[model samples]
Target: MRGGVNMSGWAGFSDEELRRMQRKGAEQRPAESGSCPAPGPRKAASSAPRSRQQLQRERALQQAAQRSRAAGEEALQAGQQLSEPPPERTSPGAPEQTAGPGAPSPRPEVKQSPAAESEESREEAPEVKELDRQEAEEVLRTRLQVLQQQQSLMEEQNRVKKDLLTRTLQLKSQQTQAEAAMLKTVRAELQQLETMATNDISILRGRIEEADWEYSKARKRYERAEAEFVSSKLDLHRKAELKEHLAEHLYAIIQQKELRKARKLEELMLRLALREEEREAGPAVETQLEAENVETVKEADFEKEAGTEEGAGSKKEAESPEL
Candidate 1:
């Protein structure tokens, strides 16, 4: 019984142990089955998807950068292609494109608005701006100098014109004075000529009056001489007639005296003859008587004859001869 009891006990111990073991096994198995496998692969797959998305983003960024570099190169090449060559040199007064040796090439003319110029100036280096300002100041100085020179030239020209005008006025005044003097001299000369003419007229009048008086005196003397000549001729004719009458009267008286003398001579001859005859015949007594008688008769005749002759002679002498 002991053996059986021991064996039963052993079997019972063994069954109990087996039942605990099974329960532990069941618990361990359920526990082991309840714990699932870890989800590492799913996590890894999610992470891989996220990593690919990020790689795609990185490749897009790289492509954009490569395109930007290519465009920048194309722009640089285009800018170089569009740029023009330098312009040719030109002669003075010629077109800008004209070619010439040793001449400066034309530069591009840049026109800027106010805003653009301000921006460019701001962008310029400090040294370059300083140089440009100095150049501008020099240009202003040159312009000022030229203006001063022009003003001086104008003033000089004005002074010269004023001097010429003054000289011209002086010359005109002198000429006027000279003309006035000439007129005065001419007037004086004319006055002198008039005076001389008046004096000459007076002298001529006096000479004419004297000539008239002398002519009147000469005419009167000529008339007097003519009257005297006519009276003298008449007196000479009367004297010639008186002389002829006186000569005729004297011839007649001489003829009468000659006749008386002839008669007396005849009587004396007769008396003498008678006396001679008586003496021849007669005596001496008769001769004495005759002589006495003849004496007495002769005395009486002489006295009477003498008285008659004296009377005749006195009458003839009383008439004087005309011549």
Candidate 2:
């Protein structure tokens, strides 16, 4: 019965008392709630230095925030000081009072709290930055469009220049071909002219040869006529000499005939003279003869008578006387 009663008293102890007991136990066991249990004394010393470094970093951030608040309050006070002036008065009939040194200094206007001003500035800054960004984007887009237009214009200009060059070359080639054809035609005309000139020269040479042959024939005929004329003159001179000789011979023959006829007439006159003389001489001779005969007869009779016959003769004489 005594052991049971002691056990109940220990179980019924107060919570505060129990906590005190736990604290005591912790102190005795070398550990606290907010601290790590150290394996040894050296580890506990290392943890204490790390906790001091953390506390110093937190204090630095708090002091920076307080300085920013002080600077913002000073700027607000300076702006308010210049906004308001003291009250003034004017009397009727009195010269208007000019602003003077007697006037009260201006009261500073109340400014907004630091927290409100900071929030407003922050809001305005974001709006200005957005507007600048939009302007820059617009400028970039305009520049890109201008560059594209310039490229298209350059391509069109190149196409136009290429087409012009091609047309010029084609025209030049056509001109060259036309010039060549014209030159060919001129050369052909020149060749034809040369052939005609050669033919004309040959014909002229033939005409000259024919004229030379005719001249030679005419010269031969003239020479033959001249020879005939010379022969006729020589024959005429011979005939004149023959006629002179014949006339001289005929004159000589007529003189010889006249001399012979004169000789014959002289012979006939001599014959007639001879015949007349013979007739006259013949009668005289006859008378002489008769006388002689008478004489002779007488003589003869005388002789006869002288002889015996003389007688007879005398007789005959006598007979005759009788008759």
* CA lDDT, every model vs. true structure: 0.45, 0.45
* Number of backbone clashes in candidate 1: 0
User: How does residue 304 of candidate 2 score in lDDT?
Assistant: 54
Candidate 2 structure lDDT: 0.45
Per residue, candidate 2 scores C-alpha lDDT tens digits across 176-278 of: 8999999999999999999999999999989989988998898888788787667656555554554455446445544544454455435434533554466
**RMSD from true fold, candidate 2:** 47.0
Mark the regions of model 2 whose C-alpha exceeds 4 Å error after superposition: 1-162, 227-323
Q: Which ranges of candidate 1 are over 4 A from the true structure?
A: 1-162, 230-323
Worst 10 residues of 2 by lDDT: 1-10
TM-scores of the models, in the order given: 0.30, 0.30
